[model samples]
Target: MPDGQEVHYGDYVQDDRVHKAVYADQAVYESELDNIFHKKWIYIGHESQVPNPGDYWTTWVGKERMIMSRGSDGAVHVLYNRCPHRGSLICNNEHGNAGKAFRCPYHAWQFYMDGSVRQVPMKQGYDGVIDYKDPQFSMVRAERQGNYRGFIFASLSTEGEDLETYLGQGARAAFDDICNRSPQGEAEIVANCFRIIQHSNWKIFLENQLDAVHPSITHHSTGDAAAAMQKKYKDKTGDDAPMGYQFLADFTLPFEKWDSLQTVGFPNGHTQLTGYMGLRPRDPVTLAHEAALTDAYGAERMDEILSTNVHHVIVYPCLSVQPPLQQLRAVRPLGPNKTLTEIWHFRLKGAPDGIYERALAYYYHVNSPSTMVNADDLNNFRAIQEGLAMVGGGDWVSLHRNAGQDTVDNGVTHSVTGMSEMPMRNMFAAWKQFMTEGN
Candidate 1:
């Protein structure tokens, strides 16, 4: 249907705008999967998801099904989820303990947690027919895998920059900020996560993550209602309303306030938005958490850790991390017009229960599929997909907001205004490079 012609990345991507075909063309989407997701460091499940030997969580890397398993030796292994024998999926459920090894439900061919061949059913039948001990008979391991803090990422291709070099300072700060907040300097994933199938391209979701201008307009109703209720509750009870109300109310912030914030973009497409939420309150729970942090890390260190003002960090092409809130959303592109997002929340290892509760509140109130905030975003994503598919109105999606006004320092670009489209432009620049260079 695409005239059997190759889609040129340069023809579609421009300095301040990109063609809608990038979002709606099947060929472009397939190219993105091959050139970007498969080649880049895509996030797998967190190490905490499989804390014990034989524990595993299934996820996707590009179009490949993958398993993140903890081996008996206390090492985490990323393996192809497909069984070597007959090529059936080894783990059907999202996550479960495989006990000692993974056995293919189809053929009973067993593989170790580290993806080494353990046993083959009826080995005598294949004595001369095939060598079951060959590595080919074992579940294939990922070409490259790395962990930052507790988060795990795997690249299908062996070639490319190492994980740390790829992450750069901006993305590294995401994990550092989250883990450093805890007294134990560690964070653990919650048992389960919220999975969403957004009816739009994955890039739309990522673009919205740092889009400072859309919140006050797209979420105006929800924010206004929450702010009104916050006042009503305060007037009635003579006390501050719960943080949940404040979370929604913050979206009603004026455009000037949003513009005052700063967004920084890295060469690798990672971007960060300065924090807008007041996370450090003088409440009893906050004070208790601060005391615990101060005891673990001296008073000055605690202040420095808590003072890191980052609201969201996009580990481009894969994860959108809100370090301050302990929230991460991983994007899996299902198709040109479909995307899957896995929403996960983390708990500070030695933080006060109230701190975890606060993260939980944000998770349920903002990130969960049932929340109005998420629903609004989902609706917009679907609408955007539908609109981009049309041929009449416009072929280009504008990224002209505050264009050419960004400051560049040492290869990183800093937006002059938070409302600038620097993040989107930064991402598309990386997209073009990845698509054209096949990196």
Candidate 2:
């Protein structure tokens, strides 16, 4: 791009095999920041994160630091963190209640939650040098921003489809599964989250979200340990183990079951992995939660909502969600081989506290950075990046498993089997389009 040279994406991304350079090259990384991450709708913090007026959460859109804030009017706003005067960060911390205004740490330039300049210090200093009335002096907002089901997104580029259109049905189904479980038909964000910096390309993390092949192979030890613990608990207490242990034990499920599960890839690179492990076990706590849902929406609707099993949803290159468990991960690509993922879980607003506790257990044991499950996945991602650095390790990574057997209807790609590589190929198809089409 620097020399006006064309990037033949086909060289790196074939139908089934992707070249290593796409994951390792610095130039490719720069191009991704420009063409993919910046242009596409990237996930920001949820609306519940900054519920109170003047409350703000700091985040990133591509490499640029950003702030998501709630205004006095109760409207959510996203803005670049930089002060227009000297380009210093307005909110230095991750998130905090800026009660009245966002006063710059570098200087006293103040800004409203909506990014308009509330006041500029020493108005006489720029009498002739600048136009004080111009909106340019205020914080720069993202070119476009939208929220769907309380999830917030911001795009640096002014172009592209609206957020709802971009999310497609697969992603919409995920949000519905999450929200419909709550009697109030909404979910609230849990304050704290686990932040992990994975040493691999960002795309690799998204690819692994719906990948059903790696769980049994990479997480075998963790699965066995959990299963053993579960057995020990049942034998000693003469009662079934908690759902937490069962969650990990399911990872040891045979490949046949994984293959039976379905994977659907939607447009704009979003994809979904159908539910495998049954989550709706009958118990006192679960029954109470189900009763609450039933009361809110009646038996028939509650049955339809509870029966929709969604294991995972990847809102391509930005967010990975487990709507059934009320957890999602937001990805931030720091460099070619470095990615920051924030794992956040939610509480079903009107459901019983026990349900939130169940979600908490999954958040801690499965997605947390210290957990064996996530650690194993991170190690594999790093290893793949490291291997790509080796000259003789081969040039392309294969996505040939059941590649041609996928079904395509109405622009959606449905894998013939859950273990098929259709998800990877589908994502690359999007990657190639986002890179080549508009450039």
Candidate 3:
């Protein structure tokens, strides 16, 4: 195809494989910003990030800058960051308290936390020329917004399924599992998050989250070193290594072990991987945490909550959640070849301090930008992106691993093998629907 030619999106997607242009083409990337990110329910910041009235945080939805603010009435609002008067950004900092109103630095135009126009300077200058009371003069809010638990999401389209329905069971379980572990049945966001810009397409990051086959191969060195430290610690001090060491050592699990696990695909591209990590060891920290939950709810209910087996959930096209680790990475596409990911971890309210420390250790050990596990994955992502952009190498990327072997029941798909590419296929299916049908 020639440059600037009108491309049919359906031609690039198939049942088993997808064309490389879907990951490399500039046109396809632009279409995605409109069809998927703008129309779908994209995750905004958590409600706890802006707990107090007039507090605000700035984030992105597709290419637009957005603000998540806490209003005086104790409701969360998602609004455009732009000032209506001169098109200036209302909040210049990433996050801060705006007191009672946001005063634009450009012309001192003020607006309330909920984006209602509050005061205008020199009102007599345009007495009958323009009505300042019109909505156009105030900052614009997202077309629709919804909250699940404490997490928030906003959609630019007026029509679509509600947030919970869009999330389906698989994605909803991610949030529920995270909150249920706390005695208070809630999770709060830790202030600030690690941000990384990867030289790869946004979809590539989502695909890698549930790839299942790459961890043992890619992070082999890191896992081996951690395992060695575990043995050395036991031999010298006669004590078991910290849980942080086990976090990395788990990456050394053989391919057969990974294949024994299961992956499930739900509607609208949501997918989940069953937990493989042994998180329920009889350590003192674990016992104390379990006791707190058991006190809040009975023993049987506490066991049910702790026994929920889930490792990771992909909230298609936007979020990669690890409910077990209390970590979430939000995807933001900068271009066809560049993507930004925000790494956030939550603290389970009313849980033992040791439990929170375990989550923090995983945050720095496995998910942090400096960790070897992420470094290995980042190298592969950039390499894959570079390979796809080249001509004459190949036209399609194979997703044939256990493709036709998946079983479907009540609109959910279960892979025959853990290494199956069903999750990738499922995401592209949703992508094709959004691109071709404009849903």
Query: Which residue window of length 10 is worst by lDDT in model 1?
Result: 1-10
lDDT of 3 at 292: 98
lDDT of each: 0.92, 0.89, 0.92
Q: Which segments of candidate 2 are over 4 A away from where they belong?
A: 1-6
How big is the RMSD of model 3? 1.6
lDDT score of model 1? 0.92
lDDT of 3: 0.92
Tens-digit per-residue lDDT, 1-439, candidate 1:
2223655676788889999989998888989999999999999978999989999998898899999999999999999999888899999989999999999999899999999889987789998898888888989999999999888999999899999999999899999999999999999999877899999999999999999999998999999999999999999999989889999999989999998999999978899999988899899898998999999999999999999999999998999999989999999988999898999999999999999999998998898877878788889999999999998897899999989898899989999998899999999988988898852
Which structure among the candidates has the greatest lDDT? 3
Q: What TM-score would every model get versus the actual structure?
A: 0.97, 0.97, 0.97
Give candidate 1 regions above 4 Å deviation.
1-6
lDDT of 3 by residue, 109-132 (tens): 999998999999999987999999
Candidate 3 clashes between residue pairs 3 or more apart in a chain or in different chains:
none
- Please give the TM-score that candidate 3 achieves against the real structure: 0.97
Model 3: runs farther than 4 Å from truth? 1-6
lDDT of 2 by residue, 11-120 (tens): 67888888887899898899889998999988998899998999999988789999999999999999999998888998889999998789998779888899888888
